[model samples]
Target: MDEAGLSRRGLLGLAIGAGAAGLAVGAGAGTAAGVAVGRAREREDAESAYAFFGAHQAGITTPVQDHLHFAAFDMMARTTRDDLVSLLQDWSYAASRMTQGLEVSATGAVDGSPEAPPDDTGEALGLPASGLTITFGFGPTLFETVEGEDRYAIAALRPRALERLPAFLGDDLDPAASGGDLCIQVCADDPQVAVHAIRNLSRIAFGRARIRWSQLGFGRTSRTTAAQSTPRNLFGYKDGTANILANDAASLDEHVWVAASDEPAWLAGGTYLVARKVAMLIETWDRVRLSEQDAIIGRSKGEGAPLSGGTEYTEPDFATTDANGAPAIDPNSHVRLAHPEHNGGIRILRRGYNYVDGNNELGRLAAGLFFLSFQRTPESFIRLQRSLSTDLMAEYIRHVGSGVWAIPPGARDGSFVGAGLFA
Candidate 1:
């Protein structure tokens, strides 16, 4: 089976042939090594848990987890503002308990009567907390109705940056998977734990809210902490190599955390989240030549070094040239275009994941990167994506889903999330 079981090339072909069906490929034999190393690190993290009530949301600055279950929900018709507030209170209480590896309620998982349904689902009964984090967000449409009417009397409280993202170039966004009035991001080292969190939260929202759409993802494509080795995407590329680290307090404050002076009082410590479901055309990408792939990404495939030269962390010499005198890094390469140097130093905290959803009707693999990022404002991502529209890599991917949410500051003890807005 060669050193990599199926060779890199062979795996790519198989991924496309089998419709990408949740296949995880490695660079030759290195994949097994990487998996072994990753699991060891995850084991340590699984044993470590974070506080649910804090200054900022846990998942934003918290160390990235191995699994994600993100869901967006819409308030039910005739739902009152008080109903929403109560739901958030319930959610916050449950979240706090779950993070500590406890049952949803004090009754315990199996302590309830035999005829009654348990408050907490038993799927994760024996599991550790697994470093789970649950973050809540309010969508643009959450502040107002489809007709632009104020629903909760908090229309004026909406941050100007919370508006729906303007349509950008090359966008083929799907309405079914797009906007939502609210979003919940559940992350954990264990897939079952993450899923369990979402399942219980959805159950609590039964009458007042309904899930609009949801996504399940594994093998996080980005690392929030610097100690992690950069993870790879389905396209066999190192993703988020230059991503902002959680330890960079200066960058986080300037680029990620919302300053009190930036907007409305309630949103002072909050940030904005932008999500896009970027579908990678594995069939086409697998057919491309290695040299072209490297040129398109502006990085060496094996080492992930900038094409301009040096190691992976080496600053790209965008000005330098090869013997022929042409620009060493392609102008439209993913790196050159998205680099902070080219974007006024604007940076976003990325926490994306690789996703494979079986096959499409055409018999091709339906797989892609579930793009997730947080910034001080929505403009950061909009500006960056606008510039990236000229990228040569656009041809190999399609943006099928999109959403923008206003992430509120974390809830303090004795209060629910978004409590300030209601005040």
Candidate 2:
């Protein structure tokens, strides 16, 4: 293999083994080396991540779909303020550099077991050991950037601003769902390195920018969580149910991977979509009685199972008839409305997160979803949103925010897009 490929393979090997020595020391050292070599691989992997952001300058493009949500409030201390600002600058610089020459690859796990591997492609692969996910917020800096660029460029943070739930909901925040104003979700592959990279980036940003607060998230995969499934939001429903599957190579090509088109030769192998929505009113939703809510969502709120009753992965029997001979799932039901049988079915992939807004005038009742989905075209997503907009859930949910973005494909070492596109 070429030097760049060789280095990536070596790094993957080290990363797969970094957990054995524990994440702190070995992963940290590896991350430092990765950063050192990152500059050289800029045109390959890092740059692609950056280009993904550059192309989709208007939306949130977290490295991973399953972000560990965290939210926090600003501290009153001057020292805290100074520290935050410095951290923001560091974060911006490191992330910008990391994305400069991004490359990605999939490797067999260390044990060589038949178990499936996590999808570590695109920006998700760049995450450090400790970082589970990252989320940017809407602050003065973010707003300024958005207004200046006519797009949302700010990234999210984690660990949340407050440990205790805010007073808005009248009860303590759900520990798992509580998030930071800004969050950096670490990678399961190397949590320690991810954590250090995030911290370093935060420090850089703080030193140079006027950031207020940020947080961190550290957690294992669903295989390790108490539920033995992916973490659920405050509503007790599983999130990221429609993520691109790992084992199906053909499906990956059809759904997740987009081939280059003629429009933007520079954007060959790039994909684009928009994902934005307001948080749901969970507290009020909770009061509505379980059956009613289930009907509204067309799934078990606790397990995210289809209303007809099956595991998350099982397809709902939309054609099954009830005792009365009518369709078991009503035609106007949330699920039915959102997922009709015809027109190729509800095809968009949803990779969403939850958010809590304390600034709302309605006294905050466990806000709704930070709705996000991915698809080849906006039309299908638009159809789903339109259905939701007119559905029964519309009474409680609202679309307060939105953004569009593109996800570009990976590149090999030293081979930039324009070099081939404009050559």
Clashes of each: 1, 78
- For every model shown, what is its TM-score relative to the native structure? 0.90, 0.51
RMSD per candidate (Å) reads 7.5, 15.0
Regions more than 4 Å wrong, model 2: 1-128, 131-231, 240-243, 309-311, 343-346, 414-423
The digit string of per-residue lDDT tens for model 1 on 104-139 reads 998767998888888988887766688999999999
The number of the candidate with the highest lDDT is: 1
lDDT per residue, candidate 2, 1-423, as tens digits?
233342453565554454444456654665556545543543343222323123222112333423333223222223343344444434433443333322221231232334654222233233322222332322222212322431222222101111211122112233333322233322222333344434444433443333233233222112212223565655555555544444444543454334454234433444434435455666676689877777766678777777676787667778877677976665666666766463355455444555554546766663556555555444556556565544666666555444443333333333321122223
Which ten contiguous residues of candidate 1 have the minimum total lDDT? Answer: 1-10
Cα lDDT of model 2 overall? 0.42
**What is the C-alpha local distance difference test score of candidate 1?**
0.86
